[model samples]
Target: MRWGVLGASAAISRRVMPAIAAGGPTTLAAVAGRPQSAARTTEVAAAYGARAHHDYGALLADPAIEAVYIALPNSEHVGWTLRALDAGKHVLVEKPMALSEADAVRVQEAADAARRTVMEAFMYRFHPQQRRAADLLASGEIGDLRVVRASFAFLMGAAPGDIRLAPGLGGGATWDVGCYAVDAAMLHFGRAPRAVRAVLSRRPGADVDTSGTVLLDFGEGRSAVLDHSMDYGPRSWMELQGTHGSITIRNAWAGADEDGTLTVLGYAGTREESVPAADHYRLQVLALTDAARAGTPAPIPLSDSLRTVRVLEAVFASAADDGAAVPVAEEGTG
Candidate 1:
């Protein structure tokens, strides 16, 4: 698969680009950046044997590019994805695929119309540890899942100008890190929450949330409590409480350091398992390519992305109301 990366984003330059170059049957065919960042784009493209385009349109127009990895900001995801699909390119848009569920659904419609393979890039889901956890749950090792608690946060220091803290551009702790916690919960539960209640705190004078804690109810005693913050020190972990046992995952999102670890506690006793150290970014690209080659559906489907955005919308709504529970509308219900 020939992949072109749109935007010389930090994630692209530091992570996904290198992963694509080093992994699987995919080639880093081209890279584009804003017109002002042409020099940087060229430098990065040169390092990867890819063509450099100062304008994103030029990259989309390139006939040699088979797919596009969109590392644009959260607000730009749906628009660029629609354009890429119209340009006859498969797309891998970064997570929180759109700012709202309506936008995500529109993107899905466009992709279906264009018959392109489009996916939200939740790289962590491709990690072996996540796969192993799924296997365990299916095997009834943890019995029936009852409750989930997840947290993903990191101290941003004094960089007020940082994009995560920017007034607009979808800057906020929830949009930045809370999405990961919610996504992980959905991955385990395999269902969208019926209701969500949340409390979000914004930094002084900032319009966006700086931190938030959300509760998702799936009914029948299945629920999740997810917390995220940008003002807090580095912290990431998830603990799933089930009927027979529990599964705890540290470093649930990136897993960039050590091998992914999950510990299980049950009547038999406590046991820990380690999945091989793997580059989730690389794994994501490989999985996309493999699906393309094998004529299979994407590893993560649009329906799943829609569900995630629905939950996100519910959380935001609940936060706006000071933790008043908000009903989540199932996709297509409205």
Candidate 2:
């Protein structure tokens, strides 16, 4: 898969671009950045032997590029994805594919019409530990799954200019980090929650949330508790509790090499499962490329992306209403 990157963002430089450079069925063909960042973009592209474009449209116009990796800001995800699809290119877009379920639906419709593959870039899902954890839950190693608790928090510098602190750019701790926790819960439960409630904390004079705690009701006495923050010290972990036992994963989101662990505590005794070090970003790239070549649905389908946005919308609504319980919108509903 010949790939073009839509931005010269830190994520692109630090993770995805390196993954693309790593030997696989994928290659870095080009990179595009705004005029102000042209030099940096050129440097990044040259590091991997790919072309660089000052304009996103120019990169899209490059016929040699078969796919696009959108590492743009959260607010730009939907528009670029739609544009990439119209350009006859498959897209692997950064998470929070759309701020709303409605926008996600539009991207889904566009991708289907274009007959191109589109995937939300949730790299952690491709990690072996995530799959192993899921398998353990499915094999009844954790008995009947009852509850999920996830937390992803990290302190951000008090830089007022950071994109993460800008409301108009879809900036917020919830959108940036809480989405991971929500996705983890949904992945394990395999269904959308019926309702959600959340309490948010915001810095004075800032419109975006700095921290939040959300509750997802999955019915049948099952639920998920999620918390995220940009004001707290670094913490990332998820725990799944069941009738008989529980599974805990450390470094659930940041899958650095050999830095993750999955511990299972069941009826028999406590045991730690060894999850080998692996580059999930490269795994994601390979998976999407293979699926695109085979004309199969993306590994992270648009429907799943839509469901996650729906849940996020509900979370925001509940937070705005002072933590009132907000019901998640069903598919095809406004």
Candidate 3:
């Protein structure tokens, strides 16, 4: 698959681009950024042996590019995804595919019309550690899954006017990091939450949330708690508790840096299993390319993206309503 990039975000220049260069069945054909950042975009593109465009449309217009990876701001995801599909290109959009369930549905509709692959880029899901964890839970190693607790937090130390601090850009701890926690819970449980409640800590002069905790009620005596913060020091982990045992993952989100371990504490005895360090970003690109070439279903389907945003919508609504419980909107619900 020949790929083009739609932005010069940190995730793209620092991670995705490198991954695309190192892994294949895919190639970085071209890249584009905001017109004002043409120089930086050119530098990045040149580093990966790709052509650079002054604007996103030009990259999409490149007939050689069969797919586009969008690392644009969260608020821009749906719009760009629609455009990419309309351009006859498959898309691997950055996570939180849309800010609302309604918009996610819109993206799904566009993709259906285009008959193109549109997947949310949740690279962590492709990690060996994540796959191994899912296997263990499915094999009843952890027994009946009961609860999930996950946290992803880090100090921003961002300069003034960083896009992450901009409300109009969909900047917030939830949209940025909390999405990973929520995703982990859903991945383990294999379903969406029935209801959600949250308490958010807002930035003093910004409209975006800086920190928050969200609770997902899955019923059947199952639930999940997710925590995220942009102002806190780095701390990330996930724990799944069940009837007969529990599974714990440290450094759950980015297992790319080093070998990751999953600890199982069950009825018989405690054991720790190791998964070798691997570039999940590279693995994700490979998956996308393979699916696209084979005309197979996307690894991260639109339905899953819509489900996650529905839960997120409920989380934000509950937080805005002073921590009142909010029912996750069913399809077509207002």
TM-score per candidate: 0.97, 0.98, 0.96
**Where is model 3 more than 4 Å wrong at Cα?**
331-334
Clashes of each: 0, 0, 0
The TM-score measured for candidate 2 stands at 0.98
How close to the true structure is residue 5 of candidate 2, measured as C-alpha lDDT?
92
**Total residue pair clashes for candidate 3:** 0
Q: Which digits, one per residue and each the tens of the lDDT, describe model 2 over residues 1-334?
A: 8999999987678888988878668889899999999899999888889999999999999999999999888999999999999999999999889998889999999999999999998899998989989999999977899999999999987796888998899999988999999999998999899999999999777779999999999999999999999999698999999999999997788664755688999879998887888889999998889999999988888888999999999998998899999998676675
Itemize residue pairs with steric clashes in candidate 1: none
Mind giving the per-residue lDDT tens digits that candidate 1 earns over 1-334? 8999998966679988988788458899999999999899999999999999999989999999988999887778888899999999989889879988889889989988897888889988988888888888888988999999999988876575677776568888988899999988988998898999999998677668899999999899999998999878589888889999998887777554568889999999999997777888888888877776676789899899999988898898998898999998876794
**Residue 191 CA displacement from its true place in model 2, Å:** 0.3
Model 3 per-residue lDDT at 56: 94
Worst 10 residues of 3 by lDDT: 325-334
Candidate 3, position 67, lDDT: 94
Regions more than 4 Å wrong, model 1: none
How big is the positional error of residue 42 in model 3, measured in Å on the Cα after superposition? 1.4
